[model samples]
Target: MANDKTSMQLVANGILKENPIFRLALSMCPAVGISTTVMNGFMLGIAVLFVQVCSSVTISMVKNLIHPRIRIPTYTLTIATWVTVIDMVLAAYLPEAYAKMGIFVKLIVAFAIITMRLEMFACKEPVGASFWDGLGMGLGFMIGMMTIGLVRELLGSGAILGYDVLGFKPLLFFILPCAGFFVVGLMMAFFNYIEVFYKRKKGFTS
Candidate 1:
């Protein structure tokens, strides 16, 4: 029971408590930049997911051999390698998404969330724990992106995934880059509300 609980916590942490976007606010660039639409958000989210999981697993396997002093550079390089792979793949096969994403996909290398995990979680944990952490964080980030995108797309375009639901666009402002922050802020508030409610229900007061 204890092992299962630990593993569940590892996976759940990123999805809620330490959510990279809504909670931790780690990588806002892609969250606001490409999340103008669900398709754009999903594409970038997939790219981030691949990089996070792969880098975490790789770092976990090789952390001991890496010199502590050079670990930052090493993590950057490792993330860059995966970023390059995804970049090439996206450009070749998913050209439309690749174009829409443009430099944002490449920018994944410097995303604080990825490098932070490498240094903080992957470097110290066993491979299994690191894998769960990576998966959780990646999924959390992906969901955040999609949620933002879905709202923006619906509000901005009067559509969801290009299917028109509303006869008219609800709000043109939501499609704007600035709107990303506003939407994120609102979502963050809601997220915090739920977190607090859960904590209180669990009998915690802080």
Candidate 2:
């Protein structure tokens, strides 16, 4: 039972405390570039989740065999291999979504968050722990992207998932690259505020 609790905490840490976008502020490039629409962000999130999990597991399994001197390149290659496979699969099977996502899917190979996990957590942790960490981080990234996308889509185009909600766009700037920074900054502030409030409440109760 204690083990189960620890595992759940590991997952929650990524989703809430160390969220890739809102908390750690990693991988801002994709977060800003592909978040113009809900679909775009969601699709990119799915791709990242798959690659992060696979790469983390693979790295953990082989950590013992890797030489310390060249591990970074090896990790990069492993991540790139997964990214390539995913990119090809998407292009072949889901051509429409792939077309929309384009190079962003391939770009996951270069994301700092995924590589950081490979070096910081997966390399040092047991396979099971690494898997949970990867799962948590991946889900966090997905949720963050989805939130940004949802907000941008709703306010910028007055739509959700491409369906018109308000009959007209209330803020055209929300869909632009410049507005991504503003939206992300606002969301980061919101999450930080919630975190502060939670900590204060916990402290008072204790």
Candidate 3:
């Protein structure tokens, strides 16, 4: 473990300061594509969480054995292995949601958030720290996905988790691809404001 950070700090960093979506702007393609419904976001987020945690720990455990020249491919293979496992699990147990998610789950191997962490943190951190880091990032990604999904679904469909609660759609455009970017952009601004407020509250900035 790194002496500079405790496990809690590692987790908090991923969840807040370095959120994969809102803060880091990582994995925007997937975020805007499949976040049309709450279920889709939750399911894909779970898949990513599993893959990220597994790959992070695996890479950390074998980091010393990997060659510097081939580490990129090595990381891809490690991530692919975990992605395959979760992909199959989702297909087998959650066929309906899997159908909805389609290729997004499989494409998690290409997610910049996962690959970046593997290269930047997992490859250098101890296994325990890597695990915490992965857990934190996985959770942050999941939360971001779910939040986007909830907003899009509620506004687009006037429903929550496919159940009609509002009785009428307010912003039908929100269901479209263009709205995905708009919603994300709005969310990014909201989070930015919150961060600024928090820093001011803590006297960390003027």
lDDT (10s digit) by residue, model 1, range 1-206: 11343767987998988889987889999987779989888888899999999999999999889999999999999999999999999999999889988899989999999999888889988888888899899989998899999989998889998888997988999998788888888877987798899999999996
- Per-residue CA lDDT of candidate 3, range 1-206, in tens? 46479899999999888999988899987799999988888888888888989999999999899999999999999999999999889899989989988788889989999999999999999999999999899989988998999999999989999899999999999999778989999988997798799999999965
The TM-score of candidate 2 is 0.91
Q: Which residue segments of model 2 deviate by more than 4 Å?
A: 1-5, 196-206
Q: Which window of 10 residues has the lowest lDDT sum in candidate 2? A: 1-10
- Per-model clash counts, in order, read 0, 0, 0
Which ranges of candidate 1 are over 4 A from the true structure? 1-8, 194-206
Q: Which residue pairs in candidate 3 collide?
A: none
Q: Is candidate 2 or candidate 3 better by TM-score?
A: 3
- What TM-scores do the predictions have? 0.90, 0.91, 0.92
Q: Which ten residues in a row have the lowest lDDT in candidate 3?
A: 1-10
Which candidate would rank higher by lDDT, 2 or 3?
3
TM-score between model 1 and native: 0.90
- What lDDT score belongs to each candidate, Candidate 1 first? 0.89, 0.90, 0.91
